[model samples]
Target: MYSLKKELLKKHYKGDNKSVEYIFNRLTDYCGKPVRYNMSEEEPDYKWDFYNSLFFVITVVSTIGYGNLAPTTSFTRIFMIFYALIGIPINGIIMVTLGEYFGKSF
Candidate 1:
C-alpha cells in the first residue's frame, strides 16, 4: 500500500519534488502510527451481549442518552424512537413512585 501510494504520489507530483517529499513523509507517518496505537483500541462489546444490552436500554429509558452508544441500522433507529417514547414516561413514573415511597419511609 505504501509503495503503491508513493508511486502514485510521485507520478501525480512529477515536477514538484519538494511537495512530493513532504507528502511522502506525512503518508509514512500515518502508516507507522497505527501500530503503536492498536493496543489501545476499544472493543465494540456494548449491546452485543444480554447484560450490556440491558444496560444500554436502561441508559436510553432513563434519558442518560448516548453514552457513546447508538443504534446504527435504519430499523433499529426507528424502533429506538418508539422505545424511548414509551420507556421514558414509564421510567419517570417508576422514579416518582420510588421517590415517594422513600420520602415517606425516611
Candidate 2:
C-alpha cells in the first residue's frame, strides 16, 4: 500500500491521470491489506473514501501539508526522502504547466 501510494504520488506529480487511476483501482483490489481506518470495530473511525485519499495524497505531494495526517515511522520518513526527491520538481513543473495552460485558456 505504501508503494502503491508512492507510485500514485509520482504519477500525480508527473500529471499522469491514467497512471493515477491504475494505482487507485489496484487499491480497490487489495482493499483488505493496508486498511484505511485505525481500529478494528463494527465501524472504524475516519473511513477514507477514494477521493478523500486522493486529496490527502495530493496535499502530501504538493507540500501543502495541513498536518492533520503524517508518516509515523523512521522507514516511512526515509521513503519520504525518495518521494520528495522525485515529487517536488515534478510538482513544480506541473504547477508551472497548469499555470501556463490556464493563462492561455483565459
Candidate 3:
C-alpha cells in the first residue's frame, strides 16, 4: 500500500519538483509524519474555506453584493439570485434574533 501510494504520487507529480514537494508535504501531514518542506512557498487556496463560504452566503442574503470572489458565470449569477431571494428573509430573521439576544445581554 505504501509503495503504491508513492508510485501514484510520483506519476501524478511527473517530475515537477514543486508539485512533488507539495504533495509530499500534504501526504506527510495527513499521515501525522513530520513535514519536510516549508509550506510558505505556496499561496493557500481558500476557494471553499468556512470564512469565504460564510462571507459569500452573508453577502448574498443581505444583498450587499460580492467582493473579489463573486460568481463569474451567468448560470452561477442566476442561481445566486434565486438563492438570495429564498435566503434573505431567513437570514434577516436570524440577524434580528441575534441582535435582540445581544441587546438583552448587554
lDDT of each: 0.74, 0.68, 0.74
Q: Which segments of candidate 2 are over 4 A away from where they belong?
A: 1-49
Candidate 3 runs further than 4 Å off: 1-46, 104-106
Q: Where does model 1 exceed 4 Å of error?
A: 1-36, 39-47
Whichever of 2 and 3 has more TM-score, that candidate is: 2
TM-score of each: 0.58, 0.48, 0.45
lDDT of 1 at 13: 66
Worst 10 residues of 3 by lDDT: 35-44
**How much is the lDDT of residue 43 in candidate 1?**
45
lDDT of 2 by residue, 6-86 (tens): 655675645666655655666666774433322233433454779777776787789898765566699987887788788
**TM-score of candidate 1 against the unseen true structure:** 0.58
Task: Please give the range of 10 consecutive residues that has the lowest summed lDDT in model 1.
Answer: 33-42
Please give the ranking of all candidate structures by TM-score, highest first, separated by commas: 1, 2, 3
Give the Å shift of residue 84 in candidate 1. Answer: 0.2
